[model samples]
Target: CIILQIIPSFGLPAGLFLVLLIGIDRLLSVYFPIFYKFKNVRRYLMYHGLAIICYALLQYSFAYVYFEDRNVICGPPEIYQGKAKALWGSLSFTVIILSVILYYAVWRKLKNTPSMANDHRLFRSILAIMGVLILGWLLTITMFVLVVFLLDWRGLFSNIHLQSL
Candidate 1:
């Protein structure tokens, strides 16, 4: 159970970093086509992987501090609280925002190119996928904010127990 909970602490940021990297790749391909064409993508991908691992480890360290004696099997009530949760949410939000900006820039550049008309369908599909992803993250962020500000952590468990009975 602990492993299940801890894995996401590492995986979540790693996944977000990958999305950010994808956005960066798209931005570069569109904004600097000549440079991007000859770039060593394999090397850049390796660098991206390393950077993701480092960031995930850093995120996991923050989680480890609050994980001393917490019971994670119950739900996010134990995992998503305090400074660690705040820091994670903020970092994830920043990544999402940056991705949105990068993708938008790519879209604008592609739209302005008269010869790239055939790529619109592909770009639209990508936009739809990204839209859903961003919406899910927005919902998650809202849930965290509500849990932190509106819900009383102690009372929450009691209410769940009462309702279950």
Candidate 2:
């Protein structure tokens, strides 16, 4: 359970951050083509990469301190339950909202412009990627909320194990 919880706790945020970085990169390429071409992309990428790493580390540290427990169970203690739920819920919402906003801005920017076939294809691909990300994360968030708030986990786990056979 600790391994399961820890992996997603680090991965979800990092994935969202990577999406945001991609959006920013696309915006830069579209709006500042010359500067974007001349800029040291590696430096910018390194900085953003480091920031994402730091953010993941911080999240992992929080989970380690407040959520992980080997003595009782491989999950958060009862005292930290609310905090853990709130933390993940808020992070999910934040990612969803930001992705929507970024996608909207990109769509609006490209709507009036006459673009080459390649550009249009790229735009469509980006839109699809964002759509998939939002859907997947939304489903994950819903499950987390349902499991944490709406259902009894003891029974849920039992039913899941029974059905797996």
Candidate 3:
């Protein structure tokens, strides 16, 4: 029950980090080739480290999210019921959607560039994962929403439900 919080706590940020990484990398490759080519390895590593920290913050944010004062479920479904569903929901999926669009754009643009080489493959893989993530989240959200509404309709969800992220 309590462990279910781990899904949004860590999942949102982890997904965001990947989305940001691939999105930013694709943008750099297409519009800032020179800078991308000459980027410092140390800076690159630091950037990734920063991404990691961002993920951590997002994960821990759940700790402070609103939890329902009372609830009913086999597990803690109401743990993050109404903190701010729209914000976190948008944040999680927006990154995924953007990643998909950005990767495809970069890939099409770089298709003919000889320099694309192994990097193209990287983008290809990113694109694939973006698809997977997008699909996974979409399906999960759809089911969760269906359940939420079902509970709400049937008067299963408690009034005390709350969450911020």
Q: Is candidate 1 or candidate 3 better by lDDT?
A: 1
lDDT of 2 by residue, 1-165 (tens): 656566666676788777877777777777777988999878988988997888777656556566634354444222234465566566656766676777777777787678898998989888887778877877877777676767766787788899999
Q: What TM-score does each of the candidates earn?
A: 0.78, 0.71, 0.62
* Residue range with the least summed lDDT across 10 consecutive positions in model 3: 156-165
Q: Which prediction has more favorable TM-score, 1 or 3?
A: 1
Residue by residue across 1-165, what tens digits does model 3's lDDT show? 335565556554665666667677777867788998999979897888788677646545553464445544623223444654444554555565666677667767777567646876876787687767767766776566555444555432443353322
lDDT of 3 at 55: 63
For model 3, name the residue pairs that clash. Answer: 82-163, 83-163, 83-164
Top-scoring candidate (lDDT) = 1
- Steric overlap count per candidate: 0, 0, 3
What's the lDDT for all of these models?
0.74, 0.70, 0.62
Error of 3 at 121 (Å): 4.5
Candidate with the greatest TM-score versus the true structure: 1
lDDT digits (tens) for residues 100-153 of candidate 1: 788888888877876655677877788778767877876776687676657778
Q: Give the candidate order by descending TM-score.
A: 1, 2, 3
